[model samples]
Target chain A: MPDAPLISVRELSKQFRTFKRREGVWGAIQNLVKRDYRTVQAVDRVTFEIQRGDMVGYIGPNGAGKSTTIKMLTGILVPTGGEIHSNGYVPWKQRRQYVKTIGVVFGQRTQLWWDIAVIESFKLLRKIYDVPQRDYDERMELFNAVLKLNDYLHTPVRKLSLGERMRCDLAAALLHNPPILFLDEPTIGLDVVAKDHIRQFLKEINQRYRTTVLLTTHDLDDIEELCKRIMIIDHGRLLYDGPLALLKQKLLRTKQVKFVVKDSEQAARIAVLEKDGRKIEAVDHLTYRIVFDRAEVSTAELLRQILAEVEVRDLLIEDEPIEEIVKRIYAGEALKEVSA
Target chain B: MGPGVRKHVELLVAYAVQFIKVRLAYRADFLISTGASMLATAFAFGFLVVLFQKVPQLAGWKFEEVLFLYGFSLIPFGLFNVVSLNLYNFGNDFIIEGKFDRVLLRPVASLYQVIFEVFRIESLHEVVVGLLGVWLAASRLKLAWGPLEFVLLFFFALCGAVIYVAIFLMLTCVSFWVEDRVGVHPPVWNLIAFGRYPLSIYSGFVQFLLSWIIPFGFATYYPSVRLLGRPEFRVYAWLVPVVAATFLTMAIALWNRGVREYSSTGS
Candidate 1:
């Protein structure tokens, strides 16, 4: 049979009514006697789907309901309205069974036993998940091989480095061989090398086990490397969804070039080219930035043009950043803000 | 559900192993903590005995009998510290640090995970010495023991454990909403200090309240009386824990409701 979607959510929403607070103990004391409540629409009517083995990035700014959406998808939070069918089970409704088929990693925390060796934590999980002895042994061997857990299998989690702790956390979450993994900020606060290690491992896992991954991360590299599709939500609403390439195509076609020109006269002419404004950005004197839109002029062609106009020593080019795209999306832009 | 003991024993042992291993890693701190706990409990119980040595009976029970109440109270209270102390603090760290989301990812019961994470050995020494005190007091009383009577006493002592766990479980469940008991809960150590002794000494209304409402009698007095061969409390043998477990179950249901609230709002 062809692959059915591993996760299908329809119109899931969550709202929280919070108490309005003033200040001081007296104000808190006042809350005890008489109450006030304000309602916050945390996750507003979000719906999406993920097929088996598809790695997708679920991203939004702070308070954009990113974590809330992940929570609902993981069956930790029940939606105020809507239907969710995942891995042939209704998550929150059949929690005991549903959780068995998924793993989750929260980057800011450690899930292993704090004082015990890493392997001990895995063994405990083995019993908790009830994986048979042989299966557990095999998985343990494989995890140790891939994660290099042998180096710290006997070290208490508290002693592990931040990167090592995250590795152990990932290993602990997956010991059950769950079909899907939910990773929230799994590379937050890590050094670049550490982040790359984790991202590469995640990619391998997704390919090898066909683990459908739903990731919420601050690092765009995580999205760029692992997720084939991107979903952006803001103010509790789903803003965009589709292929990463499609997302990149719509908004920005130019790689911006920045350089320090040696000649002031050359800078003036560059500004003239820039004011043409079709897709050129050149500032005179100290810093000159030239916008090179791919649809307008080839990057090499723009470089040749800039070379003829000015004696350029140092320069830099930048692809349109995801953060910038998200900013515009949050600014309530329509689909027509194409930089190219 | 799935061979309860068969499943839980190994896991609980794992928890113990981890707890002890952690304690061992901090050997100096463990030694100091153990000493401090033993000293504090000894002084407190000793002071109580001195204050009441001149009296005929405290709350209508003799000195040794009061020790029985005190002794039985420790088992469940100690067991609770070992099992659920981290669960009491989970609401704070889980929310502030956002670790609750990680817990939701696991394939086990949330309640089980919460309770299993902590292993508090700080107060365990107190309970051990307290049990010894009970044995000494029992010997001085020169009470004749029958096979059936001894079994009943043992079973009744187990009920004290049940009652303490039941109350603790209920209170910890309340933490999801209130979050801080250091401010909100009443000064039970002073007001319900009568619970540490026999409940028979309190007024009729107070006795009824402690026995049925707060159910502290199940933790101390009811079991003490049954061991004392008091006919009035003989029926409490079966009733204490069965009745208290019902209350415990209600607390657990309330905990479920609280977990749902947290998972939804994520505040």
Candidate 2:
């Protein structure tokens, strides 16, 4: 009905069995005779669908199976159970053919050869993907215009700065013009300026080409700036999946409202308005800060009550920061699980 | 040729061109490494000559026959070194360092991509010296060559190269499970070094080990002996292609299993 949503993953799961060894010499010798292994559920029945042209962020804490899920989607790792159908192809089963339809960039690793020039690496990828000469030239031109790659096109990849290498990598991945792109921490170690450049390029490609992008990153700024839909996974389980705005609204409801009153008498009267669940603190003799849950007390109603009580000179209302919201979400989930 | 095969060949050639360019950029290192390989081959040949001077024949084989076998062994070894040398780095660079994920992400078979990614042009010196050694021995021995013998020589060399590659692939695939253990190349190289001499000189077990266990003999000794018109070992010579195909299949199977077992390191 809705173009079948470009990527469909149904209850995909991955489990790993890792050997456990002891610390000392005796334990090492004992390990040879009788080995012990523990099974870890790295990704457990994670399910989500991504529509065409949607930029979705996949996020989690360390060892939360974010990379494992990305690897499965990119056909690098076979899922231990369940199914994944991206563009009508089962990723791991039809790996070689499926990979031709997608591009992947793991931030910590460069797909290009270390000693080769950026252009040489792109040419090699062209041959590898069998992209026609005309298409290759067109893509290179477009990438040069958008990514400003002409500056370091002839420089070897090893000599390029991190930001330059990442830009070239993004161009190389897209040279084949794949309809889907998977970026795992694509801006992991980049500075603020470089991160902005990569995010802008990704947003453009996703919009212009209708490319389905599934990005996994730790930097909240990356998620805030690029992703519209956010999926949070923890302990191999998907905890939240929906619009980023909705997630903020659901987990974060408190807003801070600061009022600058004309006199100390007005401030004292406003501080008395904190009788309900709202909290009021005296910043100085002239200013009063009120922290209230927007869901419980509407900002308009609070303003009305304040005006009815005393005359206010200036007032400012601010929503909770995304960083604080995300921290609370993680901490809340973690604490509840421990207590349970 | 099918379009798929043609594309793969083109990709391989493209990769080779880049690799050559990279090697050329470090001209001094390239020359030194190539010269070192040539000098090592000469030293091995010089040792054989000195040993032959002290004795008319060793292990029921003449000096010329042994020299031919030695040279014949290098052909496949050199080709393997040039084409599949990265197999030796599977444990360290690919597995332990988690670089194998890049190979899997490509739109080609991982084995095919890894095999053709880098061509060590410096190793070509081994092939040249090997061919020279074989020709010198053949001329000195006054061996007669018919068209069929020439065809057989080429066929055996190809089969020998396949066997060598198969063995290399199998050993390197061990990294998929072991993670990092310095790889199996060093011991495999030592075993291959034995093939430069007549298997007849070794004990019964050593000969069996070379002939069947690891099949180093099929790569060099049996092929060389058959080319020299020796009928006694001709029975084993017929098994060359059969053994090569079997080992190659096993190697691929092992590699796939290793890929499955690969618990990729790092986030």
Candidate 3:
């Protein structure tokens, strides 16, 4: 396994034989005796890898196997088919040993011991992870500086504010200084300030410890703040995998060029309409909204035509956002394919 | 400081210290609750004495002999509660909150976390009374014991403890598929209450079912048979380990299969 990636997954898939309901109690009882079952392909053949210290966002819509992938990586669930090697250990086959190298923090759930003070929970974690006394103290000190856990160190986790609790959870996950961290929706349901605090702490830890991080979240802000690269999965397959800037470069190609003409004239709108039927929408009196598909016309060319066609009062050209492009990508609209 | 024992000892000591710290945090609550629990159980035993003063026998067993069984049962039952009771709702929590995720991540066996560190601080009071009852029963019965008897008694107690935990773990393993289990497996705890009584009185198939199938009979019944100096089924003594092993293996397999179901289904 020398020179092997820190995380490697190939042709991984999971199929569930879900039970079906019949009708009445008699039917239920009969079905119980010899039931009919239907199979669901939750995760189709999907593959990806993460080198050590990479913070990669894993994303997909609901039922598109986001959590399923995370579970297989964390050793919580064994995949029905495929290979996953993390830190030189098969996650499910050798779960006990593999888990020692990883820390997982699920934002919706907590790992801290309930009913105990945060400090006590930390001590228990120190024991569970078997970190030496010196190392535990050093990590606690680092966490104090990074996550600001001292504010609620003596308070039970149950009583903490959401932000404080997230900080504590972050500290708990890293006490062992695991070489890898898996964060499932770590910023979900958090206020902006709280999300920022967690995102900041994550960046600091990743930079300081060089730990590989696999983060899955719905908040795109998490991606912008923490990840340099992302793997976008949809329909149980990778749609895009690259640096964040490249996805945006495609969005930059397609910019919205709006024109404010001299007066409320149908001739100006007619002229604008003639240029592009589907892409142009009448915003108001002599105002037109034109969407330029980058492949059909460059932003510069679209602007030059709009300026030439209308006597303008005011005009604005805005760069299209990547979120909208990804939306288009997921909607099955063809993107100008990136050259490999 | 040897590599293997280091982690085991570290985790045990950590939990022990954490439990102590938790107990200290609510000293008044701990004292009041622990005192009430001790008193409540002692009153039950006291009530038994009152009833025995009048009738003198239950199903042909004398009051002192019944006390011997009752005392023996509670001490080990309390020990099981104090050590392994974390397993009672562990599987449900594992399935529901995905705490089992952490279980898979640690270097040590998840079984250790489920089986140990389960100290029921609320029931620490019961241990005191349980020991006291065992002493009182020994005095009342005037039982003779050499070093061999003491060792045998310890083994019997250990066997009871393992069997009790094994039953709960099987129930926990079932929670992977079972959503609401508080009703389905009330028998696990309810049976602990019945263990206080002798199996000899249950009569017919009830005795057979509890004896072999669930092995409630062997836990207390066989050891007491040895205590009575009666000829016993020698093969049944080995059966304790066999039953415990089989149930543990089955429960673990079910747990593995259940986790597989959860990953794909995400339910």
Candidate 4:
């Protein structure tokens, strides 16, 4: 039982049937009797598992079913087909009891009462989740220390700044000390400083309490900084699921190397070698940049070729940026490379 | 009581206290709304007085008897107002706007949280006004307050409130499918306008609709008739409890289905 995954999902799918409205008056009138409904497959057979202490990032483009998957996992929306067992409880069926074992935060919305003070909302959460007084106090202290909620804890939620409110929301979700945490864009629209604070707090909690976190975020830095593994979903299908490094390595076929040469003559000599998806550009009189497909040519061979032909002073090698890799994945280009 | 029930009760009390504090913070708004509600109730009473001046009786019912019926109807209406006006917003605020996500995130039942989240303290004026109208009508009609009558009145008011709650709950459930902000509750809600007067005033079909179909009449008319020592409606008066239980069961079943069909908006 201990070796079993803490959160397991098997072939989960959700299809939403929306009424397709028509254009003109005739179509509208016809819709009243024999309506037309179009079904959208929001989540298609998404399957993954998370260990008790693992922080996993669930990322996708807009309308890519990240929120739908998170919603199903959190028991807010039922899955049309498939199985989800978080802590051995079927989320939708055993909602009232299952929800007690997990905490969820939707970044776009605050669970806290708008008109009440931030502390009051926390207090309400404490009662709703039935947190022990001693435990509540301890968690509040820790959250205050890490999240820096002291300044706006007494202010009404509507009056707090976005960063302050997001911090309070994170604290509220944790007060119950749920073993599993589901966050959908928890750091959305936050400044860099606030985003760092939230990411730090998330990391600390995941390590200290062994809280299993399933985070869905558009912020790539959140994934880069916190998640060791990530699942990429798009068009309702799980595109890629593996270690973050492996995903980066798998999706990126090209590497860039910038070198400082002796003169424009060395740069011109290197520019002639541009072939087969490899392009060389001159920066100035003594510097040149070479982009080569890693599959066709290794970094060492390229370096050797450059060193053998030209007088190379200094060089730096860099992998493709994660943003571009993610963009390619979302646009359905990475699927071909990933499968191959 | 069990721990689970006790926890819910404690939470309800906490929400009520917090809501009162929030209401108190906006004293001017509270005072204006409360005064407006009082004036509305008085206007209703004033209409009744003017009508009695025009006609000695309505459909063989005296002004005092009709007043008692109107007052009795308010008991359930007030109860529904306090707890369930929020249900009217389920489609727009919770479903379309995705605020229901917060409710489902909690460990409590969704309905329980929604009902208590925004307790309408201001609507308690309806119950106070109802009590005043009942007291005034009872004095004018010289209605005796026997133990059976008092107990019957309590059940009538309680069951009557349950009926309205059930009806509104079913109406609110329509939002789960329709996905519209403006609910299908208003037209049905206006049906309550007929329940305060005697069913005899309406045509036979409307009476049948009130008695059997929608059943708001059982909440006010049948119970009032039976309380006034009218033997004809005694059987219908006892059926009030039965009607309430049946409708509530249907409403809860519908609500459960609605929850299952809940497809949350894209975030």
Question: DockQ of candidate 3?
Answer: 0.53
Which residue pairs clash within candidate 3? none
CA lDDT scores, all candidates in order: 0.75, 0.85, 0.75, 0.87
lDDT (Cα, tens digit) per residue for candidate 2, span B1-267 = 498899888887888889999999999999999889889988999999999999999778888888889888888888778887788876788877778889888887789988887788777777788788888889999999899877887788788889989988988887776544556688877898989999888999999998888999999999898888876698888899899999999999998878777633322
Write the residue-wise lDDT of candidate 1 on B11-130 in tens digits.
777777777878878899989988887787778788768867778677567787777667766655555446656655665666545666656766666777677776777777756866
DockQ of 4: 0.54
lDDT comparison, 1 vs 2, better candidate: 2
- Compared to the true structure, candidate 4 yields what TM-score? 0.90
- What's the distance in Å from true for residue B209, model 1? 2.2
Q: How high is the lDDT of residue B12 in model 4?
A: 94
In terms of lDDT, the poorest run of 10 residues in model 1 chain A is A273-282
Chain B TM, cand. 3: 0.86
Worst 10 residues of 2 chain A by lDDT: A331-340
Measured as a fraction from 0 to 1, the native contacts recovered by model 1 come to 0.72
Reference-based TM-score of each model: 0.89, 0.90, 0.84, 0.90
Model 2 C-alpha lDDT per residue in residues A1-340, reported as the tens digit of each score: 5578789999999988777877676976686678788889999999889998899999888899999999999888888888999998998788889999999999999988999999999988898888999999998888888889999999999999999999999998899999999999999889999999999998889888989899999898898998888988888988888888877766676888888898876766765576667677888888888888878888899888877777889989888877777677667544343222
Error of 4 at A174 (Å): 1.2
How close to the true structure is residue A338 of candidate 2, measured as C-alpha lDDT? 21
Model 4 DockQ class: medium
